[model samples]
Target: MVGDYDSYFADRARRGAETSPTSATTEPAKTAPAKPRNAPKSGLTYKETRELETLEKTIAETERKIADIETLFSDPEFYRTRAAEAAPLQKELESLKTGLDDAYARWGELEDKKSGS
Candidate 1:
């Protein structure tokens, strides 16, 4: 399957190159991206930054969703709207709470390491 996919994309690329006028040029192709350095050289600085940012964004989004559900619950008319409607929200709330807890724990661990160093 992997080879098939590679070949499929390769075929498409060939087709595209044939269709493009620039394909006739003798100019060299663009260079590939630089190889990533080892963690010690970078000490996970870039990865940790990205991870914390993504986690914070996800946590904020989850909190917003939980707040939205809470707002729905506050509506006297929405009360007992149906178990089917509220059950999914309850499930999502539980999942988000767990994820937020995990993210905070990881963030704390990263901060501790950063400070200890």
Candidate 2:
């Protein structure tokens, strides 16, 4: 699980670097041939970039909420005392899992498009 999360973040960092302006070093920055104003280095259109950002936000938030719920479920005392509450939380966890799956699928599609796969 940690590997999955780490890979996601590493991929995000790589994509972010691709989209950002080139950093200047001690030497003068060499200018590359200019691309069209609308063309980003990542090869995603502006709309697709926006969609990716939104999807990333949703995925991160959903993962966080799922982790919180999982932590709650892991506590035996909480479960023993609040078995009734567990059913609603279980439903919520399933719902969140579904949404996370969808978000990941969409993310993969966008990534594939970006990679020209």
Candidate of highest lDDT: 2
lDDT of 2 by residue, 7-115 (tens): 9899889988976665533467689988768754666788998999999999999999999999999999997899899999999999999999999999998988888
lDDT of each prediction vs. the true structure?
Answer: 0.76, 0.90
What C-alpha root-mean-square deviation, in Å, does candidate 1 show against the real structure?
Answer: 19.8
Best by TM-score: 2
Over 1-117, each residue of candidate 1 has an lDDT whose tens digit, in order, gives: 356888999988988988788756658788999998765532348788788778778878878987888888677777556546777877877887888789789877766666655
In model 1, pairs of residues that clash are none
Q: Indicate the worst ten consecutive residues by lDDT in candidate 1.
A: 37-46
Point out where model 2 deviates above 4 Å. 1-42
